[model samples]
Target: MPNSAAAMSKTGMVTKIHTRIRADPFSAHYELVGKELGRGKFAVVKKCIEKATGKQYAAKFQRKRRKGADCRMDILNEIAVLELAKANPYVVALHEVYETSTEIILVLECAAGGEIFDQCVADNDEAFTEKDVMRLARQILSGVAFLHRNNVVHLDLKPQNILLTSARPLGDIRIVDFGLSRRMDSITEVREILGTPEYVAPEILNYEPISTATDMWSIGVLTYVMLTGESPFLGDDKQVTFLNISQVNVDYSPDTFDGISSLAVDFIKSLLVKNPRKRATAEECLSHPWLNPHPHPHPHRHARSASSLDEPETSQSESEPDSPVPSPDLDDLIGSYLTCPGQGELKAGRDAFSFGEPPFPARPEIQQEVIC
Candidate 1:
């Protein structure tokens, strides 16, 4: 797979990335330093240390061919997105890429902070306060603002995809997992029906055009979940979740928003709008009164701490999280659709639907979920 450039089928679109897939065994350069991080249908993320610098990184192995389809171009689309994020301060850095005959492994800077999902699920009193969430929201908005400024939308922005620089003292957030990211432009529209169901926007379900505003919707969900340790749109199953999102069904009851500030609710309201155009921009979110009430975190204040990196982590980047579906088929359909799917995301937004047989086709029961 030495820089194959098979043109996209109908659009004749060529990837912007010069993905020089190195034909080297990943171990020849990097040493596996920790336990395997996570696994999915076609990908697995593991903690590895660069032999040259002893710097720890997450090595993600993805199949070159998923099912019967050649996915080299789709992967290139993801690489192009990462290249854009590489220039941003709050994103994980993609350091190296190695390819075996069957699999390609992307080496990325390791974020030891684990996932924000961990904090959201924590029952401890100190896990988060309104102020803590505001700070985290600001950080997320900042990174998202940068990406949006560059005309990219991170289609997946759940808590599981956001990582902390450190777990203790609840460090500054670093946006990871760009696998589902897409570049937006005034001339062309990107549409796809693949995302973790809970955070997906209405436009995606409708197969409508995607924009930076799409990322804003997920931010709204993330903020809501962070403020109250509950999912706003999740239901008994995927269909229920999709229906809730399609109809803009969200819980704002006194019980759900107990002790939460009205400004915070307003902030979520501004973002969770059914129409993408009505949703607030990342920059607007940063200026919202909810986040402004507290002095937003200064960039230098949240530097990565060595103590945090030394701690063992249980975070898994590739596994489907928060899907209430009992069928493993749906789980794979949700998470494995993207590469790595780490907090440092690597999802594809190409016309991969044209590929021969989906990499991991859902059982007939869940196939409708994919087309939705």
Candidate 2:
């Protein structure tokens, strides 16, 4: 079963609902062995070891309210989605859940590898090759297809939201943060101005109807970032970036695609079509020639001594929630940002997670998708 986190219905509805969760304190069964792995506006991810098995996991503590706003249902929405996709492997799994006076903790599988954003910016020898990209693309599409099939759209798909099970020699991807996700339905037409600027679909900016094609626009941007290490539509600022995307002003210069395949370029072209109807679906993307299962030298890098950026004191990982004893209050830890290396860098930080901005806030849902 695939899994995800955030507050929303699988059918694309953003409404409040009750969740079945353990109301006991999270510290009763799991010990906070290390530090907070990551944090955002309304949540913090911490490293916890289940007392029962000593198996490690990442516990996300999401605030029930933001700035004195009651939003407990937001947390429940995420749990609901994770619960819905429990069987899909590509999406991260929610091992367990717990509730407290102020927060809900989601125990998840700690991903040993970090966010693919690292690989996108990785240098020289560690750079991802076509084969590596293909492998990742398939996994991403498989997960997306799973979500789409369920009528859910991860409206904010980006490299930071895509995590790897293992970084070295690369491994399967685990899609995270469904706060912005919505379920698509034949009966309802979803429309909203949401998502990270660079990865956002044009229709969103134009205030047009939203659909699965919205996510496809992001996949195109993500693919370009993976192949070229540069954001195709990133402009001087948010407005310029919006302009670039609105006009489909992508740069497919020789320098950008120098060593890349023409098929890869064509794949991106197909997805970046200004018209959402013209963009490829997740299943179609899986069948694109660029992703054809062709043999090539393994591009997954071997493990090496990590640099400072590769290691952080408290990286986010997957874990299930359980409490074994009295735990420290998270007043300081919960809101403070983590430089977790084991889990990955807190990709966006507070600015990214602020309900105010939309590079889709740095998240512990650290999220970009909370459309509330």
Candidate 3:
């Protein structure tokens, strides 16, 4: 895949998958450097390394299609969301998008620490401090701020979608997997309902107008989920869940909700407002006292770290070193999706599927920088 704008024009979309990202090559151009980080219905994400940079990445290889796979549109919709969200630090960076005749390869940023869900769940009885919650809240606000600025609404915003760059001291935070993302205009609001079963706002369930505030509701749900492990509203059935949302059947049991701050709880109440018109903005959320309870100890002395200022990182590894991974035959995966000239080429976000080309040399000036 060439970086030339010509290639972009040829494909209609500016982003195209390079040759190095293909499923099969003579040798492992991009080695399977680590074990599978996670798996989804359509793809399996593996921790990988570019032989040239030795930098780690999470490679999500789309599983080969089987008969009766219902969410093909959803799978490609995720790709479109990734396309719109490329170059944003908070959003998972999509480096390369590859296609075999049968499967899609998405080379994405790897947040080594995994989902923030683990952090939220770590202290069983112990609750997250306001400071800790604020830190994550600010990062999430900044990320969602970017998406909102770009007019993309993340229908699904939860702890599971939030990931950490490092484990112990914690590191940069990123929002990943926008399979349910929707773009909206200033005056427009979506009526169609879409979102995770638990995090969805009341308005969404009622088929009300969706806006950036819809994301705000999800964020509120996320904040509550982070402070406490359980969801605000859970029911035995999907219909029941939707009913709870529509009816705002939120129970703030003091005994059940042990250790959560009243201010945190109040902030969630404000964000989870059934009417999207009244919901808080990302900026407003950042300004909430719950998110910034105390002033910085040394505001002037706290210059941002150089590393922190850099573009988001797409990979992370342990302080020691990761065990080597045995390379596997990508051909087995690629063979199914390889090109057939007579047939239509696979299309993803205006990029046409192409292979059998040479890898583009790394650009010195434009060194790959992690955005999260």
lDDT of 3 at 96: 61
Per-residue lDDT of candidate 2, residues 1-372 (tens digit): 123343344435545433457877777899997765676556677788899999888888777766556766555656666766667767788888887787777888877776777777667588789778877787777777777777778776777778777777576677777666676778767766666666778887676778989999999988888888887877665666667887899888897789899999999999999998888888777666677544224332111111111212123333222111111121122211223334332222211212233332332322223333
Ranking by lDDT: 2, 1, 3
TM per prediction = 0.78, 0.78, 0.69
lDDT of 1 at 94: 74
Is candidate 1 or 3 superior in TM-score? 1
- Candidate 3's C-alpha lDDT? 0.56
Candidate 1 Cα errors over 4 Å, as ranges:
1-14, 294-330, 333-372
Q: lDDT per model, in order?
A: 0.64, 0.66, 0.56
Q: Locate the minimum summed-lDDT window of 10 residues in model 3.
A: 319-328
Best by lDDT: 2
lDDT of 3 by residue, 315-371 (tens): 442211111110111111211111112322111110111111111123222222110
Q: What is candidate 1's TM-score against the reference?
A: 0.78
